[model samples]
Every structure is written in C-alpha cells, then in structure tokens.
Target: MAKIEMKNPIAELDGDEMTRVLWAVIKEKLLEPFVDLKTEYYDLGLKSRDDSDDKITYAAAEAIKRLHVGVKCATITSNEARVKEYNLKQLTRSPNGIIREELDGTVFRAPIFVNNIQCCVTSWKKPIVLGRHAYGDVYKNCEIKVPGAGKAELVFTAEDGTEIRKTIQMMKGPGILQGIHNMDKSIESFARCCFNYALDQKISVWLGTKDTISKTYDGNFKTIFQKIFDEEFKAKFDAAGIEYFYTLIDDCVARIMKHEGGILWACKNYDGDVMSDMIASACGSLAMMTSVLVSPDGNFEYEASHGTVQKHYYRYLKGEKTSTNPVATIFAWTGALAKRGELDGTPELVDFAKKLEKATLDVIEEGTMTGDLARLANPPAKQVLDSWAFIDAIAAKLK
Candidate 1:
C-alpha cells in the first residue's frame, strides 16, 4: 500500500524514558509504514534541554504555533533528584507548562474506554471529557508563611496611583496567607476555548465552580463562561441538540457521579488538576488517558496525560522486559494527525488516523495489552505482553 502523504508538517516534540523508546518503535511500525510522516522534530529529552539551556522547548512551542499542530511525548520535569541524576545545569520547569503558557491554551483530557476494561465508576457508561483552564489562580499565587502575630491584608494598587486595601486576617499567632489572581482576558479566552471545543466535539458543556462561596473570584469564571455561551454559543448549541449547564463545584461532582457522562466538564484550574486525575483513575489507568492543549485560536498540542515510565525505562535499561502501556501516546499521534489532516484538507490522512486509533483499541479489546491494562481488563488478560510485543500486536492488527 502506498503511504498516505501528509500535506503539512507536524511539530513533533520527543521525550524521555520508556515512552521515548516506544515513540521510535511506534513511528517505525505504525506511522511510518502507513503515512508519509512529515515532522519538524525537536528532541525534548532532559540531556538535550540541559545542553540547549531549554531553548529547544521554546523553539518547539514556536514551531507548534507556526505549524498549528504538535504531538508530544512525555518529558521529564526536573526536580532536585532528577537534577542530580541527570547532572543538569539547573532544575528546569515542566516542558508542558512552558508550551501551555506559550500557547495560552486549555487542556482537555479524555479517557480511551475499552470494552474489556471495567470502569471503577460503574455508572459512567460514556466518556467524560475534562477541560482544564490551564492559567492563573493558585498556580500563580503569592504565598507567605507568617511568623508570630501579623495582619494579613489584600492590597491592590492601580496604575493611576489609587490603592485599595482590605484586611484578610488579624493573626494572633503564626499562620499562612496566599494571594491568588486570574486575568479577565485569560478567563475569557478559557471560556471561549471550552465552548469552541464542546461545539467542535458535539458535546454538552458543564461549567463548575465554588461561585456560591468565592462570589468574586469563582463567580467571575461562571459569569464569563455564561456570557460567552449566551452571546456566542447558544444558537449553535441549541441547533446541535446540546446544552451548557452550570452549578456549584460540589453539586457538579455529585451530579457527574450519578449521571452517565458524555459531557465536557469545564473546570477551574485547581478543580481541573484534581478532578482530571480522579476521572482518569475511575475510567482506567493513567496510561489510557489522552490529553490535548487547545488554544483559543484552535492550535492544538496533543500528549498523554501520564508521565514518562521512568521505572519501566530503568528495568529495560537493565535488559529486563517491561510492560508499559502506549495507548495514550498512540492516541496523541492520532489526534495530531487527524487535526493536521483536517486543517490541510486531507481526508485520507484523517481516515488513517482513525484506523490507527481503532487498531490500538482493537488490540486492547482483543485481550492483548500491557500489564497495567491487563490488570484492569474484564476476566483479566491471561497472557500479558511486554511493551514492544503489544506495539507489534497493534501493528499486526493494522496490517
């Protein structure tokens, strides 16, 4: 079969650990054979990032912006241990964080539901797509550990030399204080991205926040999302037979647990960070979760929600076979390819992407999967394959 030619290049950000090893094999066995892969590749490995002073990550983000599509492998975000282990110049920031900030995007995470895999929440029959507003709030907060008694005040200074101050706490003893903020522009952008993504995916949108308590802070998010939905998306959502619902975060959680989910749950940054992981665990292993960062302008960067398989990589390095799941990584590629194909008007490429995804899922459904998924499989997989063997199984299915 002649390979399906790509009309545009994908900005491919490579990474570290076992996923990186699977990345090479996946390309050779799955993508390269069936598609004329055109990619502007950047090695985002820890060593490479250190060698280049992390400029490579910035360049990769720039390329994704220019090209409008990216598929990323899981990379190491440096910590004290990692810095010492890798012998790095300094502890670097998360590559994902850098790219997300550069793109100013919302992260959407959805699980890959297989027929044989049992969901922990037995009530959840459909996939729940979670859209996390990836900017501001507690993530960019000013925190202070107050020693002894001190007055904690919230102060705001305007450009015109006006000052507004309010005492938050009159501490009699040592306490902690934090000042968190979100930009209106960023919130508006996040709202639009969620609405646009829901519209594109033909799913209902659910916005949740602690608006009842944090009337000004969380209320702003609710208000912005509501305004955007009413002004921009109401007509389209109605036409598509979908609805946008809003409720308190606690209520939303209760409702989501009871109801069968096919809804896009748009969450505040902190809520999203916690809830996405919960949803991923309930649905299946983190390896089965797929994530995409979608900008307001529709640029996308796809990646697995799970981290690099560091333990698996170490075992493999010691010449031991390891069973690391690659489902999410494979889906990441399909997502990038499908979007690229759609943008470039190549239906064949889009179809190829779909088929590749089907192939991966079909392998899982057929009771051939890595150790993690096998453990979760219904009746359990009697025979579990190592990482490479599983990829080969998917390849055979594709053929």
Candidate 2:
C-alpha cells in the first residue's frame, strides 16, 4: 500500500530513556510503513540540550510555531541528581516549560479511557480534561530565606518615582518569604485558551480558584475568566448547550469527586499541577494520560503526561525486559497527526490516526497490555509484554 501523504511537517521533539527507545520502534513499525511522515525533528535529549546550550529547545519551539503541531517524547527535567548524573554545565530547565513559555500555551491533560481498565473513581464514566495554566505564580517565584528577625515588606515602585510599601510580616527569628506574580496578559491568554478548547470539545468549562482568600491574586483570575466568558464566549457556549461554571477551589474539589466526568476543569498554576496528577491517578496510571499544550492562537504540542522511564531504562541497560506502557506516547503522535490532517485536508491521515488509537485500545481490551495496565485490567492479562513487544502487538492490530 502506498503511504498516506502529508501536506505539512510536524515538529518532532525526541527525548531520552525508554520512551525514546519506543519512539524509534513506533515510527518504524506503526508510522513509517503507513505514512510519508515529514517532521521537523529536534533531538531534545539531555546531552543535546547541554551541547546546544538549550538552543535546540528554543529552535524546536520556533519550528512548532511555524508548523503549528508538535509531538514530543517524554524528556528529563534536570535536577540536582540528574545534573551530576549527566555531568551538565548547568541545570537545564524543563523543555515543556520552555515550549509553553515560548508559545504562551495552556496544558490540557486527559486520560485515555479503555473499557477493560477500571478507574479508581468508579463514578467517572467519562473523561475530565484538566486545563492547567502553565505560566507565572509559584512556578516562577522569588524567594528569600531570612537569616534573622526582621520586618518584611511588599514594595512596589512606579516609573513616575512613586513608591508604595506595606508590611508583609514581622519575624521573631529566621523565616522565609516568597513573592509570586502573574501577568494579566498571560492570565487572559489562559482564559481564552480554556474557553476556546471547551468550545472545540463542546464540553462545559469549570474554573476554580481561591478568590475568597487571595482577593487580589486569585480574584484577578476569576474576574478575567468571567469577563472573557461574558463578553466573548457566553453566547457561543449557550448556543452549544455548554455552561461555564466557577467556584472556590475547595468546592471545586468536592464537586469533582461527586460529579460525573466530562467537563474541562480550568485551574491555576499550582492547583492544576497538583490536580492533574490526582485526576490522572484516579482515572488510571500516568501512562494512560495524554497531554496537549494548546496556545490561544490554536497552535498545539502533544505529549505524554508521564516522564521518561528512567528506572526502566536502567533495567534495559542491565539486559532486563521491562513492561513500560507506550499508549500515551502513541496517542501523542496520533493526536498531532489527526490535527495535521484536519488542517491540511487529509482525511485518510485522520482516519489512520483514529485507527491507530483504536488499535491501541483494542489491544488493551483484549487482555494484552503492559505491566502497569495489566495490574488494573478487569481480568489480569495472562501475559504482559515488554515495551517493544507491546508496540509490536499494537502494530499487528492496526489493520
């Protein structure tokens, strides 16, 4: 069969560890044989980032801006241990963070639900997509560790030589102080992105923030979302039979547990960061979660919500067979391809993407899965395949 032709290239951001190993296999067995794949490839491996002084990361982000679609493998976010292990010159920042900042995108994470895999939350019959604002707040903060007792103040200086200051705290001994901020532009971008995505998915948008306490900070977020929805999205939302719901973060959490899924929960930086993980685990393993970074302008970068399988990679190095799930990674490619197909008027490509995803879920439904999923499968898989074998299984089922 002739390969499906692609009109535009996808920005492929390659990574490290076991996912990278599966990346090559997936392309060879599943993608290359069926599609004339064109990708603006960027090796985002740790060494590559260190070698290029992280220029490759920025370059990849730029290419995605031009191409408008990216599919990324899980990469390492350098830490103290990783710094020493990789022997890097400096602690490299998270590639996802860099791309999100460059594109000013909101990260949306949703689970890949399969019939055989039981969700810990038994009431969740549908998927709940978590839209996380990926900028500002505690993720980017200034902190000071006070050495001794002193008065701490929050000061603001205007360009017109006006200064306003207020006491933050009076410490009796050593303490800590932190200052965090969010830009109005970024917050507005986040609101628009969530609303746009909700409209695209035809799902309700539920925004949660602690505006009752942080009146100035969280209140701004609530205000911006309400303003945008009322002015820009309310008509569209009502026309589509969808609703925009806002409540305190605590109430949101309580409601989420009791409510059936199928809504997009828009959260602040810290809340989203924590809630996404909780939702992922409650629905299934992190390996079953698919993530996409959607910019307000409609550009997208898809990826797995999990990290590089470093432990599995180490075992593989020791000649051990490891059963690491590749479902999310495969879905990442399919998602980007589907979007590429939709934009480029290639329905066959979109069909192939749909088939690929169905094949993956079909494999799981057949009681053949990786270790993580096998444990949760209603009837445990008789035999769990390793990462490569699992990909081969899905390939055989791709039809």
Candidate 3:
C-alpha cells in the first residue's frame, strides 16, 4: 500500500544523545514506512551547531516560522562541561531558548497517560496542562561577580536622558549580582497564548505569581493577564462556561494538590521550568510528557519535554543496548503531523498520526515498554524490551 502523503513539509530539528539515535530509528521504523515524510531537516546536533556557529539553530527557527509547523528532538543545552566534552567553539546557548525567542511562543506541556502507569498524585484524574511563558527571565539573564565592596544599582535611562535609578544592594565583600528582565509586550503575548489555548481546550486558566513579594516584577505578569482576560477573553470564557483567575504561586501549588487536574496552569518563565517537571514526575516519568510551543501567530513546535538520554547514549556508544523511553518523542512526531494534516486539510494524514499514537499507547497498556517506564508500570510491564524492540512492538501494532 502507498504511504500517507503530506501536503506540506514539516520543519524537523534533529538533536543529540540517545534520543537522537532513537530519532532516526523511529522514522525508519514507525514513520517513513507509513508516511511520505517531507521535512526541511536541520541538524541541531552539538557538533553541527558549533560548526555552523549556531546559525543552524536560527535557520531552523526561521524554517518553523515560515512553515508554521515544527517537530524537534531534544538537544543538548551547552554548559562549561559540555563545551569541553564536545570541544565546542564557545559556550553555546540553548537551541530551545533560541527557537522559543524566535517564535515568541508559550510551551504547553501535558503528560501522556496510560492505564497501566498510575499517577503518583492520586487526585489527578485528568491531564494538567502547564502553559509556560517561553521567553525572558532567568533563561536570559545578566550576571556579574564582584571582587570587593561596591554598590549595585538598577538604572533605567530614557531616550531623552531622564534617569530612574534604584539601589539593589551595597556589597561589603565579594558577592555576585544577577539581573533578570521581562518585557510588557512579551508578557502580553504569553497571556494571549494561554487564554487562547484554554479556550481551545475548554479548560480554566489559573496563573500563579509571587506578586505580593516582587510587587512590580511579578505584578506586571498578573496585571497583563488580567487585563487581557477582562478586556478580550472574559466574555468568550464566560460563554464557554470556563473561567480565568490569578492566584499567588503558593496558593496555586497548594490548590494543585487537591484539584482533579483539567486546568491550564500558566506560569512565568522560571516557575514553569520547575513546576512542569514536578507535574510531569507526579503524573509519570518525564519522558511521558508531551511539550508543544505555540506562537501567537499560529505557529506550533512540538518536542519531548525531557532531555536527551545522555547516560544511555554513552552506553550505546560502547555497543550496548539501552532501553530509553521514546514515548514523548514519538508523540512529538504525531503532534506535528496531526497539526500539519489539520492545517493542510488532509484528513488521511491526521488519521495516520492518531493511529500511530494509539498504537504506542496500546503497546504500553499491553505491558510492553522500555526500561524507564517498566519500573513505573503498575501491573509490571510484561516485556521489558530495549528501545529498538519497543518501537518494533509499536510498529507491529501499527501494521
């Protein structure tokens, strides 16, 4: 039989480590055989990124912007250790950060639930989607290490030379200073994305921030979201029988413990990074989460919420079989394909994506999974296959 055809190409950003190994195998086994895959491929591997002076990362983001659909494999975010390990030209930035900034997007992460793998949090009957503001804050920060005593000040100078200065700290000894910033415009965009997503999913939007402490900084986010919701989305939300509310971060955390999920918990940049992982772990493994970046202008980029399986990759390099979970990665592909098909008006392509996802979940429900999920499986996975074998099982189910 002929493979299902795609009307347009997907911007495929490839990555590193064990998941990178699984990336090619997944396409060869699960996707290529079943679909006429068309993608503008960009190698976001560390070595390639260094060789291109990180231009490839930007190019890939541009491709996603142009195509309006992207599927990314988890890539290594370079650090001092990574720079030496890969012999990189310099300390390169996170490819995910670059893409998120380019797209001006919000990341929505939700766990992929299977019947056999129970949630650690018993109260979570439904999936709790985390809407993360993907721009600014600690991800883009400035830091300085003081040698001795000095004064630290935050000064803003207007174009007309008007100056507003505030004292941060008066250091008496060696210390460090860090500055983080967020834009009003970016916050506005983040608010719209969350509200739009909530309306689409028919879920309540609960934004959490520490406005009482960092009155000005956190207050801005709260203010923007409230203004946008009240001025723009309040009516629509009321019509849909849904609601949007702002709460202190502490209260949100406490409420989440008792809530039955099914809420889009929108968070600021740093908060989202931490909470999303917490949410993912409580639901299941980090690899069980699906992440998607949605730009306000309708662009979508799907990726696994977890990082590259670096440990497994090292073992794999020594010619050992590693059972790394590839569920989130597979879902990333399905997500991109489904969106592509939906946008292209190709129902067949969308159907194929849905079938692939079902096949994956069915295999897990039948107690066939990799090492990571095997430990977490409630009834115990009947067959603990290596990564390749697990994909093969799903392929068989797909066929």
Candidate 4:
C-alpha cells in the first residue's frame, strides 16, 4: 500500500538503546502505515555523537530550525560514569544542552495521567504545565568564596560608560558572594513563550516569582509579564476566555500544591529547577513525562523527559528482555508530527497524532505498560505488557 501523504515534514532524531529500538518499531507500525512522512533523520546515539564529534547534534538542531519540528528519542546525557563507559574526553554536556542552546526555546513539561500511579495532588484533573525560564539564576550565577570578607558589590557596566554598583556588606569573618543576573531580553523572550503557550492551549497563565523578596530582580519578571500581557496578550486572552495571573513565588507554590491542575505556571530559572523535580516526583515516573521547547517565535521541538535507558538497553543487547517505557519517547514523535501538521494545515496528520496519543493511553488504561510505570502499578495488574508487547498492542489499537 502507498503510504499516506504527511501534512508536513518533521526532523527525526534517533537515540540509543531500548528507546532507539522502540523508535523504529513505532515508525514502522504506526507512522508508516498512515503517512508518507518526510523526516530529516539525525543519529544522536552516543556512539554516533562521539564518532561525529557531536556535530550531528548541532546539525539536527539546525534541521529542526529549518523544518520547524523535530521528534527526539531518549539520548544519554554524558556524566563522569558515562565518560568512562563511552571512553570520552571530560564528561561533555548532554546533547540536549547543545540543541537547547541552539534553539533558544523554553522547556515545558506536562504529565501523562494513568489510573495506576497515584498523584500527590488529588485535585489535578487537568495537566499542570510548567514553563521554566531556564536562562539565568542559579544555573548561570557567578559565585566567589571570601577568605576574609570586606564588601561584596554587584556591578553593572552600561555600554555608554555608565556604571551602577551595589555594595552588600559581609557580617561574618568568612562569607560567600553570589552575583546573578537575567537579561531583560531573555526574560522578555521567556514571557512571550509562556504567554503564547498559555493562549495556544486555551489555558490560564500564572507568573510566579520572588517579587516580594527580590523586589528588583524577580519584580522585573512580574512587571514584564504584566506589561506584555496588557500590551500584547490581554485582548486575545479575554476573547479566548483565559486569564493572566501573577502571584508571589511562595504563595504560588503553596497554592499550586493544593489546586487542581490546569493553569500554565511560568517560573523563574531557580523556581523551574526545583519545581520540575517536585512535579516529576508527583506525577509518577520521569519516563512518563514529555518535554517540549516552545520558542518566543512559536517554534516547537519535542523530546522525552528522561535520558537514554542505557543500562537497560545494554541488558537487551545481551539478549535479555528489557522493559523500558516508550510512552514519552512515542509522544515526542506524535507531538512534533501533530504540531507540524497543525502548522501546515494538514488535518489528517493532526488527527492521526491525536489518535496515536489516545491509543497509547488506552493501552495503559487497559493495564499494559513497561517497567517504570509497571512498578508504580497499584497491584501489578494482569494486563501488563512488556516493552515490545505494549508497542504491538498500541499499533494494533491504532489500526
């Protein structure tokens, strides 16, 4: 049978191990049956990444920029252990780091609900989407240790030779100094991405920052989000029946823990760092979460939230069956493909994407899943399917 014409082309990034195997099966069983997909394929496997000196990662990011959609598999993030295992130079940053920098997009994580895993927040009937600024704060702070402190000053030098410096006194004999910053332009981009995502999803947007404490720094985020909302998104939001709300970080976090999840909460860099972990633990498996990068200009890239199941894949290579959850990785493909279809006005491709999501969720609801979620299973139900078993089931359901 001739493959159906895909609505638009999407960049495909293949990764390592069990997920890498699952990636091919998903394509063969689900995507190939329905669409004549044009994918700009890039190998992001650890071996290939090392072989190409990691140029393939940069090329993949560039391809996604050009094509505007990319579906990535779970890839190994290099650590000291990984470095020894792969025999590489000092542990290089993750391939995701390279792509994240190149694309300059915001990472938003949303949970997949299954009947088996218990959520921390019982009221979360809908998804609590987190849009993390991801630019500065602790992730890029400049720190120095004071042998014997005198004074610490944060100095900002303007391009026209103007300077503004604030001196913070050290009360103790030995102290630590930290100077952190966030550019107005970066925060502006973050605001735009969050606001756009909220509007696009037809969901409410909430800005949370330490505005009361970091009056100047966090308040800038507050001001910018408010200004942008009023100037840009307010009218559109009102028309769509969504509200843009701003709350102090302390209040927001406390409230979010109790509230039913539906709003798109935008956090500063540090808040995002902490909250993502909290949300991940709450929602169940990190393997079940899907991440997407939404740029200020509305460019989208999707990927699994977890790293390559390297350890598990290695066992599988030795002829041992492994049960690596492929749901998040699968969603990455459907998410990118669906968005590409939506962007290109291909309703059929979009429909297929939505249905594919339903099919995967249906399998889980039917009680068949991989190790990550299976462990979380209330009673390790009778319908549990191994990795390949689950994949075949989803494909059959899709048909």
Candidate 5:
C-alpha cells in the first residue's frame, strides 16, 4: 500500500522510562509502516531538560502552538530520589505542568472501554470525562519552611506602590507556609474550555469546588463558570439537551459514585488530578484512559493519563521482561494523528488512525493483552504478553 500522505507535521515530544522504549517501537511498527510520518520531534527526557534548563520543554510547547497539535510520551517529574538517580543538577519542574501553563490548556481524560474489562464501579455504565483545569492553583506554588514560631502574612503590592496585607497564620511552632494563586483570565479560559468541550461531546457539565470554605478562591471559579455559561453557552446547551451544574467538591465525589456515568465533571486543578486517576483505575488500569489538553485558542496536546512505568523500566534494565500496558500511549498517538488529519482535511490519515485504534482494542477484546489488562479481563485473557509482544500482537492486527 502507498503510505498515507500528510499535509502537516505534528509536534512529537519524546520522554522517559518504559514508555519511552515503547515509543520508538510503536512508531516503527505501527505508525511509520502505514503513514508517511512527519513530525517536529523534541526530546523531553530528564537529562535533556537538565541540559537545556528546560528550554526544550518551552520549545516543545511553542511547537504545539505553531503546529496546533502534539503527541507526547510519558515523562518524569523528578523528586529528590529521581534527581539523584538521574544525577541531575537541580530538581526540574514537571514538564506537563510547564506545557499546560505555557499553552493555557485544560486536560480532558476519559476511559477507553472494552467489553472484556469491567469497570470496578458497578454503577458506572458509561464514560465519565474529567475536565481538569490545567493552569495555576497548586501546580504553580511558592512555599517556605518555618523553622521557628513566626507570623506569616499574605502581601500584595501594585505597580504604583499601593499595598494590601492580610495575616495568614501566627505560627506557634515549626511548620510550613505555602501560597498558591490562579489568574482570572486563566479561570475564564478554563470555564469556556469545559463548556465548549461538553458541547462538542454532547454531555452535561458538572463543576465541583469548595466555595463554602475558600470563599474568595473557589467562589471565584463558581462565579466565573456560571457567568460564562449563562452569558455564552446556556442557549447552546439547552439546544443540545444537556445541563450544567455546580456542587461542593465533597458532594461531587458522592454523586460520582452513585450516578451512572456520561457527564463531564469539571474540577479544579488538584481535584481533577486526584479524581482522574480514581476514574481511570475504577474503569480499569491507568493505562486504559486517554488524556488530551485542549487550549481555549484551539491548540491540542495528546498524552497518556498515566506516568512512565518506572518499576517496569527498572526491571527491563535488569534484563527482565515486564508486561506493561501501552494502550493509553497508543491512543495518544492515534488521537493526535486523527486531530491532525481532521485539521488538515486528510480523511485517509484520519481513517488510518481509526483503524489503528480498532486494532488495539480488538486485540484486547480477543483475550490477548498485557498483565495489567489481563488481570481485569472478564472472560480471562487467553494469552498474556510482555510489552514488546503486546505491541507486536497489535501490529500484526494492524498489518
């Protein structure tokens, strides 16, 4: 078959660990074989970030903005242990966080359902999409260690030299003080993204926040979402036969447990981070979900919701084969390709992407999968394969 032609290039950001190993194999086996691959590649591995002082990360984000689409491999967010392991100069910030902030995007995650793997939550019959605010809050925070009893104050100074101050705490002992903030413009962007995505997916939107406690902070979010919905999206939502509502974060958790899925639960940064993982695990393995960051201005960044398989990577280094799931990563590629095709008006490329996704899920539904999914397979997986073997199985089907 003649390789599918591409009208545009995608920004491909590579990363670390077991997923990084699988990234090359996936491209070689599944993508390059069928499509005339065109990409602006950037290495986002920890070492590269350390070498460039994370300039590579900023460049990758810029590429996505220029190209309007990107596909990323799972990356490492170095802690003290990882800092030592990689022998890094400094503990760099999360690449994903930086990218999200740079792009000013909102992450939407949903489970990839297959008949063989049953949802752990029996009540969840459909997919619950998680719309995560991708900017501000704790992702960008400043902190200080309080070595002794002292007073901590929150102060703000204007450009004109006007100042406002509030006492945050009167520390009676050694403790920690942290300050996190969100911009009104970013919040407005987040609100519009959720509403627009819900309209696109034809699903209801549920926003969860703690307005009762963090009145000024969380209340601002509630107020903005309502204002945007009423001012811009209410008529459209009514026409689409969907609804939008807000509830306390705690109440939202309870509601998620009992409600039959199919709603877009828009959450604050931290809430979405925690809840998306819960949703992913409840549906199946973390590798069974798809994540895409959609900016208000129409840029798209596709990536797996899960992190790099660090333990599995360690085992692989010791010459031990590990059965790691690659479904989410595969979907990340497919999602980017499909979106690229859609934007470029290349239907053949879009069709190829669809076929590739079908091939992946079909293999899983046929009882041949990696250990993570094999354990959850309802009729019991007939054959459990290692990482490479699993991709080979899907490649065979793709061919």
Candidate 6:
C-alpha cells in the first residue's frame, strides 16, 4: 500500500538530549508507515541555538503561527554548567519558554492516564486539562524595598481628568512594596486562548482567582474571563453542553484535589506556576505528563512536560542501557498529527493519532514500561524493558 499523504504538515521543533534521540524513533516507528508526513524542522538543539543566536525559536514559533501545528521536543535549558559542558560561545536560554512567550499562548498540561500508574487523585478517570495563563502575576513585577519609613500606594488616573490614588500601607520600619502589571491585551489574549481551547475540546472551563483578597490583581482576571464568557461563549456553552464557572482560588485548589476529572482549570500565571508542579507530582511522574501550548488562534505545539532527562542522556552517551520513557514524546507527535488531521479534514490521520495514543497507553496498562514506572511500581512490577524496546512494544501494537 502507498503511504498516506497529509496536507496539513506540522512545523516540527526539534530539541536536545534524550527527547532528541526519541524524536527520530517516534517518526520511524509511529509516523512513517502511517502518514507521508511533511515537517519544517528547526534544529533547536543547544549547538544550533547557540549558532543561530536563538533566532531559530522565534522563527519556529512563527512557522507554527503560519502552519498552525507544531510538535516540539524537550530542549536543553542551558545553564552555566551546560555552557561549560557544551563549550559554547554565548549562553542560551530555554527554547521552550521563549517559544511559548513568542507564540503568545497558554500551556495546557494533561496527564497521560495509563492503567499501570496509580493517580494520586484516584477519581481522575477522565483528563483534567489545565489551561495555565502564563503572562503575569509574580512573573512580571515591580518591587521596592523601603530602607526607611515610606508609603506604598497604587495610583490610577482616569481619562476623564479624575486622579485616583490609594495608599495601601505606610511602612512602620524597613519593609517591602510591590507593583505588578498585566496589559489588557495580555489578559484578553489569555481569555481567548482558554475559551478557544475549551470550546474546541467541548470541555467545561473554570477560572479561579483570589479576588476576595487581591481585588485589583485577581479581579482583573475574573472580570476579563466573565466579560469574554458573557459576550462570546455563553450561548455557545449552552449549545455545546459545556459549562463555565468562576470560583475563589482556595476553593479551586481544594476542589481540584478532591474532584475526579473532565474539567478544564484555567489559572493565573502564579497559580499555574505552583499548581502545575503540584499536579505533576500528584499524577505520579513528570514523565507521564504532556504539555501543549494552545495559541489563541488555535495553533498547537505539543511536548513532554518533563525536562531533557539529562542523566539518561549522559548514560545513553556512554552507550549504557537506558529506559528513558518516550510516552510523552510519542504523544507529542500524535497530538500534532491529530491536530493537523482535524484542521485538514483528514480523518485517517486523526484516527491514527487516537489509535497510537491508545496503543501507548495499552502498552503501559500491560505493565511493559520503562524505568520511571518501574521505580514507582506499587508492588514493584517485575518485567522491565529498556527505552527502545518499550517504544517497539508500542510500535508493534500500532502496526
């Protein structure tokens, strides 16, 4: 049989380390036989990034913007150590964070549920997708430390020639003051991204904020989300059989811990920053989580939530046996391909993604897993295969 052709090819973002190794295998084992895939590859590896002065990340993101689908690998976030190790010219930052900021998207991380792994929140039968707002709150902040007695105030002057100033506090002794800002445009972008994602997925959306406490900072989020929901999505929610709810931050966190799944949690930058890590731990291993950047315009970028697996990469370099789990990386491809299929009206590739995802999960359910799960085993499951072999197990089933 001739290989199937997909018109909606992905703008592939290749990265470093173990994921770099797995990228090739995923194409060969999962994608090649299924689809005659076309990829606009950007070498976002450490060396290439240094050589390109990280222009490649922006170019890659722009490519995604143009093409509407991206499948990215986990790249090395060059630290001082990495700089010495790679023996490079200039220090490079993390490609993932840069691409995300440039694309102006929200990251939605969903755990890859497999029967073999035990979820800390056991009730999460379905996926609980978190559309984390990545723009403001603690990430961008103005700070001042009072050496002497001083007043901390927030001043807002209206366009109608009315100046409003509020002095929140007067420092008794040496203290700290802060001013954080989020542009209306940024907040609107976040709202659109979450609304677009929830509507696209047909999943309920929930927004949480500590509006009761920090009325100004958190209230901005609440007001924007409400405005967007009411103006754009109310009737659509009714039509689509999905719901939207707003709750206090504390309540949201508590509910998230207790509730099962099938709800989308839209959080502010800081909340997402904290909760995502918590959720990652709760779901078991970071390796099991998959992060996807959903642009406001509905472009997609999928990658492993975990890092480059630096330790495993070094061992693999020494030609040692390494069972670096490739499930998340595999899902990244499946997601991009599936999104491509959906956009292009190609049911074959869409079905291929679903089946490939199921195959990976099925392999896990059968207890044929890599080192991470093997270590996290409840009764310590005996059978353990290395990385390539485990991927082969998934591929054998995919075939």
Q: What's the distance in Å from true for residue 173, model 3?
A: 0.6
Tens digits of per-residue lDDT for model 5 on 170-242?
9999999999999999999999999999999999999989999999999999999999999999999999999
Across 1-399, the per-residue lDDT of candidate 6 in tens digits comes to 577679866899888888899888888877897789899999999999998898988899899999999999988878788899998887676687677677778999887776667778876677788888766566556688889787878898899989889997987889888877777777888888888778888999989999999897789889999998899989999999999999998999888877878888999877876777677767777777778888777778888877788888889899986888888888888888888988999888889889999998887777788987877666565668888888889889988
User: Who wins the lDDT comparison?
Assistant: 5
Q: Looking at model 1, which ten-residue stretch has the lowest summed lDDT? A: 134-143
Compute the lDDT of residue 170 as modeled in candidate 6.
84
lDDT string, candidate 1, 261-312, tens digits: 8999999888987899899989889888889999888789999888898999
TM-score ranking from best to worst?
5, 3, 2, 1, 4, 6
Q: Write the per-residue lDDT of candidate 3 for residues 140-231, one digit (tens) a residue.
A: 99999999999999989999999999999999999999999999999999999999999999999999999999999999999999999999
The residue pairs found clashing in candidate 3 are none
Task: Give candidate 2's whole-model lDDT.
Answer: 0.92
Off by over 4 Å in 5: none
Mind sharing the TM-score for model 4? 0.86
TM-score of 5: 0.99
The TM-score that candidate 1 achieves is: 0.94
> Which portions of model 4 miss their true places by more than 4 Å?
47-54, 115-118, 138-157, 160-180, 378-380
lDDT of 5: 0.96
Which stretches of candidate 2 lie above 4 Å from their native place? none
Clashing pairs in 4: 4-36
The TM-scores, one per candidate, come to: 0.94, 0.96, 0.99, 0.86, 0.99, 0.86
Error of 1 at 254 (Å): 1.2
RMSD of each: 1.9, 1.4, 0.8, 3.1, 0.7, 3.6
Q: Which ten residues in a row have the lowest lDDT in candidate 6?
A: 133-142
Candidate 1 stretches with Cα past 4 Å from truth are 145-149, 171-176
